[model samples]
Target: MWIVLSLFTALCEAIKDGLCKKGLQGNNFLVIAWAWKAFSLPFLLPLSFITPVPEYLSLRFLGILALGGGLNILATILYIRAIQASDLSLTLPLLSFTPIFLLFTSPLMVGDKPEPTGFLGVFLIFLGSYILGSSKPGFWGPIKGLFSEKGPRLMLCVALIWSIAANVDKMGIRETSPFFWAFCVQAFIASGLTLLLFKQQKSISLGSRKNIFLLSLIGLFTAMGLISQMSAVNIGLVPYVIAIKRLSIVFGVIIGALVFKEKDLKLRLCGAMIMLAGVFLMTA
Candidate 1:
């Protein structure tokens, strides 16, 4: 049942990522990220109320939350920037390196060590990501159909930050309700920092009524996916949960192909299988 819930959580995360990609086309990436968080308040605030937040947080827990919040914001900002600047196919596979980063750091943060199978799983995930993310060539390139140059090295930096943040979340989860507190802290901090760092311009407005509604809907999905992922970690192995959650890439590829009319469905499907196989190996 927990595994099923984790799968659903992955689906939500994928859907939200897809929506983010759709919404970000031709839009300011930072502004869209801010808008998504702003729109998140309505849904997330109510969740905080309904879910029963703890009256008093432990000092240790509070520190963990703060660290997680910082990392979350960094990861979120970098992710948006990376996605906007690079191809999803390229950026996402690189991002999949998060699990490998987590594997090494989990022990220091929370004293959890991977079994031999777990290490094998981690290797497979990276190998699959490498294959999937490698770029194809244009008519001018060497492959004429399979050669591609690397994207921003900065995105890899962001992926590293995201990896650390994910492991931090696992550490934070052991100390509190990962769903409620982590969301509250990260959302609050991210929103506040965004508002502070990016001065609101008079020219910047929410735009059309339809876009507002749509963006907010996407925000709600983001909140749901985040909370669900946190909840899944509360019950399952952190690394395993994350490994499985990355399967959302498969869902993203499918939605991109079917709904958004993206090209290269066959290649993406093949990548998805390799990814899933890697995930299974990681957990086995």
Candidate 2:
């Protein structure tokens, strides 16, 4: 059951991210962030009604949720910023490191010592994600860009913030319902804040009916991914679950190549296959 949920979660997240990249093509990052969360808020209403409100909510839990929420919002903003400022080649590789950071931090926070096999799996996942996210013209260029201070720092920040957010989220769920009421609450708050701050740009529109419709669909997929991911972590080991979830990077590469007509499809495909081998090891 957990395995099925995990696969579904990764699939949904990949689709969601693909849509996000599409929507960001010519749109305002802040508006995309706001609109996605706002659209997703209503879907959670049913979940909120069905799940009992957590009665044992602690200051600790609330703090973690708020921090996670803030980081999530930051991640969205920075991701869009990265996409706008840099190539998918540059941005996606930086984003791939989130799980690497999560793996290292998991021990300190959760004290879950992944087995040697688990570490091996994580190494494969990392190599796959990095290769899959890099450019073919010169994979070395993206590697150099990643280390340079000028390239996609915001994306790196997103990776670090989300690593912390993932851990805090795992902890918070232990105290609350797996139905993810905290996510619902945080999304609402974040959307409200986005709307307030970005009101001047309210008049900025997608200008294309198709893009608007597609963006909404992407937002829905993202909501589903978030809900499904919470479900996976609630049931499975955090690092293992997250390591498996990184398979989304492979999906993202395929989407970029096929849907977005990104160049170097052949090379990325090879990298993606390697990444899949990593995912298999992580789950082994």
Candidate 3:
């Protein structure tokens, strides 16, 4: 059941990415980011109140929420920049690095240890990334290209930030219901981004009815994805759940090829499959 939920989360996330990428054609990243969170409030805010809260909230929990929410805002903006600057296939695969980053972050943040199998999973994921970046003759070509590419480099930063935020999310969920934690963190992020959006543009504009509908769809899918993800993590191990959730990259690649008519479909699909295998291995 958790696996099913995680897969659904991945689907919603992939769809959201496609919608956001379309919306980015004429929209600013800040406004898109703000809308992503703000639109979700209509669904998440009411659900949060109905869900049972923790018996007591601690300063530690609040600190984690604030810190994680701030990092999320940064990561999200970088993510938007990445996709806008490059192909979805190129940017999304680098996110596979998140599990690798978690290898170091998990121990410190949540006192969790990766099993030996997880190390193997990490190696497979790295191999997939190498393939994704490969174009020239020698191994050094792909390795260098991975770092040299603007989109992939930004996504690497997103992966690192998410590794920390994932742990913080687990910590938050441990203290409260998943719905409540998601709502609070998203609200904080929305509030912060709203301020920045206004400061930069002075006013928000939905552009047209068509764009407004697309942006709303992005938020709706994002809200559903996060809710499903949080619910899965609440019951399952964070690393395992997140590893599966990263399957959204595979979905994203397919969506890119079909919707955006992205190039290099053959090689990208192969790399995405290899990465998906690694994600499966993480559950072992």
Best prediction by TM-score = 2
Question: Please, what are the lDDT tens digits per residue for candidate 2 over residues 1-284?
Answer: 66667777788888887776677677766667666776666566577668767666788877877777777766776776777777767777776677788778878876656778777777777777777777553666556776664446778888788777777777777777666654554574566556655675655465778877877786677667767778877777677777777888777766876788877767777777876777677666
Question: Is candidate 1 or 3 superior in lDDT?
Answer: 3
List runs of model 1 lying over 4 Å from the truth: 84-87, 135-151, 200-204, 282-284
RMSD of each: 3.9, 2.5, 2.8
Total clashes for model 3: 0
Q: Rate the local accuracy (lDDT) of all candidates.
A: 0.67, 0.71, 0.79
**TM per prediction:** 0.84, 0.88, 0.87
Q: What is the lDDT of residue 111 in candidate 1?
A: 67
Better of 1 and 2 by lDDT: 2
Question: How many backbone clashes can be found in candidate 2?
Answer: 0
Query: What lDDT score goes with residue 158 in model 2?
Result: 85
Ordered from best to worst lDDT, the candidate numbers read 3, 2, 1
Error of 3 at 102 (Å): 0.5
Residue 87 lDDT in model 1? 63
